[model samples]
Target chain A: MSHEIPIDDGYLDMDLLRFTTAGSVDDGKSTLIGRLLYDSKNTFEDQIEAVEATSKKRGDEHVNLALLTDGLRAEREQGITIDVAYRYFATPKRKFIIADTPGHIQYTRNMVTGASTANLAIILIDARTGVIEQTCRHAFIADLLRIRHVIVAVNKMDLVEHSEERFNEIVAQFKEFASRLNNIVDMTPIPISALHGDNVVDKSTNMDWYEGPTLLYHLENVYIGSDQNHVDARFPVQWVIRPHSDEHHDFRGYAGRVAGGVFKPGDDVIVQPSGFTTKIKAIEGFKGQESEAFAPLSCTITLEDEIDISRGDMISKPNNPPKKDQLIEAMICWFSEDSQLSPRSKYILRHTTNEVKAVVQEVRYKVNINTLHKIEDDKTFTLNEIGRVSIRTSAPLLFDSYRRNRTTGSFVLIDAQTNETVAAGMIV
Target chain B: MEEERHSYQVNHLAQLESEAIFILRETAAQFERPALLFSGGKDSIVMAHLARKAFHPAKLPFPLLHVDTGHNFPETMEYRDRYVAELKADLKVGLVQDSIDQGRVQEEKGPLASRNALQTVTLLDSIEEHQYDACLGGGRRDEEKARAKERFFSHRDDFGQWDPKKQRPELWNIFNGRKHHGENFRVFPLSNWTEMDVWQYIKAEEIPLPNLYFSHDREIVHRNGAMLATSDVVVPQPGEKVETRTVRFRTIGDMTCTGAVDSDASDLDSIIQEVATARQTERGTRSDDKRSETAMEDRKKEGYF
Candidate 1:
């Protein structure tokens, strides 16, 4: 219950950018993770020893850097990742948390989960197998997740002898196909050898004609500012703090992380649902008192007046409030094992701090991930299938586009009977 | 959009803190009787901090629950009491010793034996006795591969077992805290935080922590490739050498099982430096984790926090 922040020093350089690796069996996602961890000094002696021991036991030819992240026993035995393997490494410039997800078709859910939180999606394309269906599938999901930046890591330059022609061919095909999608912020194709440690965390010497930020540089300096919703001021109350049993009993503050925009203490704000107006009393964090808080920072705030604020409530500017409505048009990814999409299926819709009874009124279409096409005639939605659906909630959902605010614009559907999460939906 | 002396001078750090605070509030509102698990560790301490920030003027909605193994360090217990008392949050202690005495659990014999694995029994009994539907803990995915498989709002069956194969998919930040009768949910707001991320956030946020986290001089003994603290609960084995060593615990758990490394990280920066260069994982020092390949998974399945 102690509200005091830990007396640790130094701030995270916002230069830290999150990226995911996409590739199957031989495409080098694991190698890339291993290489990054190894090259970045993130690999400790014990970890190296563990990997070396595993490699020796397996009787592999060389020290498999990929074993650094193959973490699961099954994955180590099978030589493939089935679940997301999150790895962390930092440079002087920034910190990184790479959601190393499986590239196999069976683990599309894992990829979707990893991509959902990424600012940039790195699609690893084997130079030998250029423009494959899985390549298309990975790209499609990355785009769907609203990932602003895309980096096609054309891996295994060593296999192609670091050929420029092959890289160009893959690049042209990808660019031609991706040009059809209008939402791409920036797409840069880089050729590297994840196995030989080319252009991962450091610049590659094998490719002199190419000049680009080594994989680490791009990740360290990728433009993520535009990814955050700087224009929408949204604060979803996570907790309410009150030090009662004294004169402070009257104190009521809304504590939460700022999802988007800047929250200034004196700014006039409107409480969602109740639509009550108030001014921010204070925004308190470890850096001491501050005037404004932006997305992703956690802070405690005291309102100028006592309000009936609890979780799931939104506090925003009156003039630029999020759309509040019960009829939601969204892209829902089914997650339940037993439940299938059906009209009027009762479920609990969880968005931010709010929970409400909701029904899937319609399943417009399901997208074929491999082909990146919408199956309009499909009657039912299955697990890991991205689809468009219309939902009607018991209470209006205060929201923004999933493109704008990942926090306020996203909702999860839970099966009422078994209490299983049935779907993850992003508001359209 | 910059304003003068706005509410507590909002910044990115404040935003993250606020989000955690909001999630804490939701946990309070969405669950019938929730208890924040206080381990007196860094992560749980941060969890408690956010809980306070969530409801500043009002008392924390729920109480603090600790399933004490009696093998825990005296410092941790003192810090736990001081912290809870300072915030006036009700503290609930469920002792593993009591569970063993009541025959709910059995004690393992031998010098190398630990009561670490037995805490789960006391924890489950406490949950049933107190009727806690939602138990919030500071679990992060980057800590371990199995933990990475967990969802934000992890649903547990009546037996308190986690089916990794049957885990509910978590999308975006929307969490499903709903459960049927007798079922429970374990909520981890820090599921996304990594060890380095947690440390960085802790330092950046200036959160207060116990002195044990920083390097301090303590009576210790060398045993089984780890430094064991010289405590009343854990006696040195026949061949183990007892010595006073300057060490800091990366994690604090049952003293009988928790291990420490030789360190001079008397400050946060030094600790971060040590963590960055740590040869073994924080869990690697945990003797209970060294018991088996799926130790945490098995303990978690039995409703251990």
Candidate 2:
């Protein structure tokens, strides 16, 4: 057997796309991921052989591709995905990271964790069942996490006779439900059969009436350039680079990933909390002085003035500085199974390289994820529960709403005593 | 076409590099005493390169700890010494032989016996002796089934045991490095990188590797359907014939368990092409993982990197 190099010299120019899969249980989520890996030639011979042996041992007809995932022993024995399993595959055009998360309702935290860093989300809908409660919950979490691109894959189309009518009906149903979400910028629906490999990697010949790009095509060509916050200039200083060497003496640079907007030499910036204003003298990148630095680029910057700035300090434009306040209202997903979130619960909140002690002032309401309704009376938050809460920090936090900037708007709460990450919060 | 590629739109290599640099800087800022777990392998070499770029002009804030198995290829050891000197960073070596001498671990005795599993004890002892709250590993999720469920910031207990079922939910780019005393975390900067990505990045960055990775003629013996080099640690077993063959290692591990594949691709481009067309996973030739179906999982649960 011969295989072509799916990539070439221009492979270095290929961009990366991180996405996550979400939907109801038994929707063939894992199989869709396996099919993607296999059809793309990313699956190796040993992995295939292993899966085949497992399938044969389990007495299954046709190789069970889902076994390729489900990495844990218990997960494989139970034939289910328990936690998030990250898988990587690359075509000549782009490199893709797939966060295959479990779809059980009790695994809401898994979906939230997987969706946190995803640039896009693939929500699988069973062609026969159409949209269900789990589907809405997945869409809700995706929207809440502010994922810009969403692909509504109407999977298992082979079971529905590859009917164009069924695909359209499911797309319509998803759009109607997704209309309530405000953060999703682009949503494309495609009919696919994850098992039979229809319109996933290659276009489906059975569904001739459906005329859309295959799932792989859309993934490779999606417009993700505008997904970042390029309008707001925010830099959260993560580390201070002082070489302490004679050759680079008198050099002090604030190093951090550009959280938002474009930063350039001579740009006027303000240091939060201290309210010190300074001008950027130079942007020191590894290659040398970069003309401009934008969101997600890790670079070091030197200021014109010798202002004392340390980790967790936010640098933004004076014209549009981030909101500075001690009281924060946000929606949080409870992730701790050992404890529950109650009023007056103290935790260490970390946001944008800064850490602060915070107290849960009040739990306003619990969100019924399936129905997207507020349960006002049930304010307690347990494991896998999400709710709106008000928190008061010991020190003021600089930020924007999660809708505006994902980096500056997100934070994680660590249990003070347990040191475990208990909640993931998005500033509202 | 050139104008279409915006500055904000970074390529996959640059993106992975940036992510790694960010993680490195975070590790520096979070941990009081952190160390990079260097194995003189390609992954750790790439990781050290990233660390250099992360804090340019400034020496690496942490030390590079190599848990020597005492059965390594000579080229790897030489490369480790030279690379450490070039970076001007601190180097710490934990020897499995020392662990054996100290009666902490017993050496296996057989044709298939290897010090591969014994390195875990030495590694844990080094972490404890050095009080490293965080150890940056070159572990990538695509390398093994157990690694697929790994988080960027993987937590460990006081006994250095990993509880996969009880991992903290890592969200976005914000990592929680807060831990109690005696407990440490294993941070993987290349958790999302695949073997192809690693090679592509190495080629793009022009990073150098040990000579063992290139094709060369070596005496080898066949065992368990893999080509094992006839080194001092791994000699010919009874009824096994030793032959000279042109081969190269897909991965760098202990000389006892690592297997070389027949290949003529000696350079970066050809090696990448070979990797692209190769029918086996990079770890497929590793005898350590071939021991059982869930060998990696079991070892990882026992605090293996």
Q: Pick the candidate with the highest TM-score.
A: 2
Model 1: per-residue Cα lDDT over A82-200, one tens digit each: 77666766777666768788876555677777877777888999998998888887888788788889999999999898998999999999988787665578998999898889998
The reply for model 2, stretches above 4 Å from the true place, is A1-8, B1-7
Query: What is the fnat of model 1 with respect to the true interface contacts?
Result: 0.53
TM-score of each: 0.91, 0.97
For model 1 chain B, give the 10-residue run with minimal summed lDDT.
Answer: B3-12
Which parts of model 1 have CA positions greater than 4 angstroms off?
Answer: A1-16, A237-244, A275-290, A299-311, B1-19, B197-208
- Collision pairs in model 2: none
User: lDDT of all predictions, in order shown?
Assistant: 0.78, 0.90
Candidate 2 docking quality: incorrect, acceptable, medium or high: medium
- Candidate 1: global Cα-lDDT? 0.78
